[model samples]
Target: MTMTVRDLRPGVRADFEGFARVRHLALPFYLVTPDSLVYDLAHAHPASHFRPLVAEEDGEIVGTAQVGIVHDSPEPGQGYVNVYVHPERTGRGAGTALVRAAEEHLAGVGATKLFAWVLDEPGNRAFAERHGYRGSRSAHFLRLDLTNGTLPPRPPLPAGVELRTGADFADDPRPVFELDSETMSDEPSDIDYEFTDYEAWLEGTWHHPLFSPELTSIAVADGRPVAFSAARTDGGTRYGTVMTGTARAFRGRGLAKLAKADSLQRAREAGLTEAFTGNDARNGPMIAVNKWFGYEICATEVRYVRELG
Candidate 1:
């Protein structure tokens, strides 16, 4: 009957499990795990000021929010507060409480602009709008039934091109880091990002518990990675493509599609049953490639922005 929002207790296993559970129920298309949650809290860049919040109702977590500033962006004072309430716990006011707490933290930290992602459902959009958030860009969550669907046959590699797994770079992951940095800069997003810190990338992504180096596919040209499809699994049957892109010089050659296809195939062979990925609605090329691979639009989320006064 009573609801309260507070910061998650980092060392508490129940807190992490509850946060991950609510997130999974709210956004099943994405991978969420207790270990990943803990890693994020412990390894976030200091400037990010990351704070994970949970809404408790009678000692049970019903909603969660990941609040932080985009510290790495060239622009300052930009913050994010993504809130997700359990699917079964809607209409309980937990979401509003979490958002209010998140906004207060961001405002105190001098964030001028705050962004959140709301599922495209009418009620979800209404909730954001009622909180003074305006819808902006949108993205699609795609799903492929790897266990039941047929994947495209792996295409022959172009001359002088070779395929490799992220595992191949275990001794030296700087090449994958460079490729990720270059491709990420070109991703379509409302917030512009710069992946400048290799050490940060290693701590935040490369060594994350969910990241699957053995299943990540890379396209190598002249012995350098030009395209890649990074994979992440929930330590279960569900596998997701965290990032898949081709470098600027290799964009039109279908290298991204090739690499991702290989990654998916590898995932299937590795016993992954479900595959999930997300794409910006305006990213036509990537969307087309996903469609070519028989991915269906499972869900959509609209980015919403609210200015702090």
Candidate 2:
């Protein structure tokens, strides 16, 4: 069975399902659903030129890639192509085919730089190095066994601090949007992102199929959101923290940890058996918070960069 890469068929249910399946198996820490995949394809900003592709072998999708230019960046020619091959299907040509196709698409769009994330395992890193990519920053995947772990019991809310669920802001999520934007801007990343487009956030995040507003915790102070831990569910037993952060003013007050704990407990009560989150290796405060939640380091991936002509 020969492996081949092609554009994802957004209109085909099976195609999108297969794509989401491969991504979940490859990066179990993140949440992906067929609906979310289709929404991303259909609602992405025109400037992004975002294209998702899949590598198929014997009618099975064994690899996936998200290829696009970094349209939001102030600098031009920056692009990204994060590819993941099914863990059980490595050693095949699927990964290479996906990479080649993504590179060609990005280069055609005049993207002069490409970024990717490879597992920190020796073989994965070596494959990236062999493909003309250089290693850079790393991030970790953390997992907590909600079915058999001792989570920190919810504590008393601090003076002047109140806990709320993201669903509380269903009437208007702009406050949450503003809070998210403030925290995201300070996050460590190769690409600088500015969340100036509220409409885009609404379509891409607020209404995302996987977003679990009921399980998402927010800490409000004086009626303003100061910290948050966003939740995404697989609509099954899996729960993932999509983003956990606190405004600069709220850092070190244990507000982020409190929010995460609240979210985790809500997820558990909702029958979620497993929890997963990703953290940049250098983020000590957030790492400590996850550690407090009894999360263990499950895997690591290093970011890689390639200069495209």
Candidate 3:
């Protein structure tokens, strides 16, 4: 089989579907489709220099890599090259070729450091180590059988607090965006991200095809969105929480739990059978909350970093 690595033509519909296929096979939780992939590439910030790479074996795409500079990071020259190969297509050297192409692309674009998320499996970890990447931090993907699993009862809302769907903020999503920005700033990670671009958020997140506004739950405290559980759907029985966080001032309260519970309950009611979420291994608080909701770790990934030229 002849394997070659090249840039994915965003204008090509097949490229979008192939990329989404590889990602869905490699990372089962994250909901993605051709529409979402095209939307992401179209809305990606120019500063990011985002280039999607694909590996083709005999005219069939088997692997993909999303390579880009972390333009929003406080530290410059930081970039990322996340590679994913179709599970059935492994051992064909597609991953290696794609990684080489992505690394070269980022390095040529002035990247001084590169990060990649590698599944915690032994083979995946060994592959990253072979590419000079060292494990930095780890995170877990959790799953809950919403149809069969019982969710804890919703906690009573605090005084002056209200529960609302993300759709309720359709007229002015700035509050939810602001709340998300604040909570995301405090999220545990190796990169220090600065999310000051609300327009970018709207383009990449709010308007994304899979974002389920009706399924997302927000906790409003005194007319302000204090906590939220943003949801994404696979347009089927699968549902996932893309982001769940509480504002700094709102931590220690049960708002996050309340929001997640409300979201999960509604998802099940809407016929969603499988629920997925993620949590940083070091984030004990959030992990505890997920556990309380009966979510179990289904897979883990480690962020691998390497200093580049």
Candidate 4:
């Protein structure tokens, strides 16, 4: 079987569905849909040099890669190439072909350092090592069964604080953007990011096809949002918390937990059966909060880095 690598053809229904299928087979814990795939390709910032590639065997797509530069980071030359092959299609040349295409594209865009997330498995790690990538930090993909599992009761609102939803900010979402910026800056990651562009956030996140405004929960204190849990739902029963964080001054007050709990209950009430979220392994506090909500680690991925000549 001859394996060939090529760019995903935009506006092609089969290509989008095939790409999403490969992603779902490789990473079942995260939500993947054709709409999201197309949306990302259309909305990605030009500076990011985002390119999605697919590896095909015969007439079927077997692997996918999303290669792009970290344009939002203050540091330059950092790029990422996340590759995933169909679980049953491994051992074929699909993965290697996808990686070669991804690395070549990223390097052509002036990437001096490349990063990839490999499943925390022996074979996956070996593949990265063979490709000259060194393992770095790891992350966990956690899942919660909202349909059958019991969620914590919503706690009473602390004095002077009120619970709100992202829908409340429809008229003006600057407050939500501000909260997102602050919390994102404090997130644990190898690449430091600054969310300085409000318009960019609106286009890339707030208006994304999967983002669910009604299920997202926010904590308001002293007339400003101090904590938030952003929600994203596939046009199905699957729901995910994209981000849950509290402001620096609001830490240690259990506000993050409160916000997440509210979002979970809302998701359950809205008929979302499955919930998913991811966390950096080094983020102890958030992991504890997720554990408190009965989220269990379903899968783990290790970050792999390689320096390009």
Q: What would the TM-score be for candidate 1 when compared with the true structure?
A: 0.99
Give the poorly placed runs of model 4, Cα more than 4 Å off: none
Candidate 3 structure quality by residue, lDDT tens digits, 146-207: 98897888899888889999899999899999999998899999999898889988987788
In candidate 3, the residue pairs with backbone N, CA or C atoms under 3 Å apart (3 or more residues apart, or in different chains) clash, namely: none
Candidate 4, lDDT over the whole model: 0.94
lDDT per residue for candidate 2 within 156-256, as digits (tens), equals 79999999998999999999999999999889888888788898888888898889898999999978999999999888899999898899887888898
lDDT of each: 0.94, 0.90, 0.92, 0.94
Ten residues in a row with the worst lDDT in model 2?
69-78
Q: What are the per-residue Cα lDDT tens digits for candidate 4 across 1-309? A: 878999999999999999999999899988889999999999999999999999999989999999999999999999999999999999898888989998889889999999999999999999999999999999999999998887889888899889999999999999999999999999888899989999899999999999999999999998999999999999999999999999989888899899999999989988999999999999999999999899999999999999998
Candidates 1 and 3, the one with greater TM-score: 1
TM-score of each: 0.99, 0.96, 0.98, 0.99
Model 3 misplacement above 4 A: none
Evaluated at residue 94, the lDDT of candidate 3 is 96
TM-score for candidate 4, residues paired by index: 0.99
* Residue 175 displacement (Å), model 1: 1.1
Better of 3 and 4 by lDDT: 4
Off by over 4 Å in 1: none
lDDT (tens digit, per residue) of candidate 1 on 92-187: 999999998898889998899999999999999999999999999999999999999978888889898899999999999999999999999989
What's the lDDT of the predicted structure labeled candidate 3? 0.92
TM-score (C-alpha, index-matched) for candidate 2: 0.96
